[model samples]
Target: MDIGVGFEITYAARRAQRLSNVVLAKARTHTAESIDCER
Candidate 1:
């Protein structure tokens, strides 16, 4: 149980979570654009 290692792990996890959120938002935006085109 090292302090630096624990901090790195937490930071990496946070970065990954943020990236996933960005990707999901982009996908939803694309879907909305397609739906708008259809209408």
Candidate 2:
């Protein structure tokens, strides 16, 4: 059970990282578009 808990935490952390990257990429993409429009 202890090993299982640790494995679950590790999996969750990886998932969170992937999600964070997606969100950050979206923000960067939108910012770039807005800048292009302004120019």
Q: Write the per-residue lDDT of candidate 1 for residues 1-39, one digit (tens) a residue.
A: 999999999999999999999999999999999999999
- State in Å the error of residue 13, model 2: 0.4
- As for candidate 1, its clashing pairs are none
lDDT computed for candidate 1:
1.00
lDDT of 2 at 2: 100
- lDDT per residue for candidate 2 within 1-39, as digits (tens), equals 599999999999999999999999999999999999999
Model 1 lDDT at residue 29: 100
lDDT of 2 at 21: 100
- Number of the top-ranking candidate, with lDDT as the measure: 1
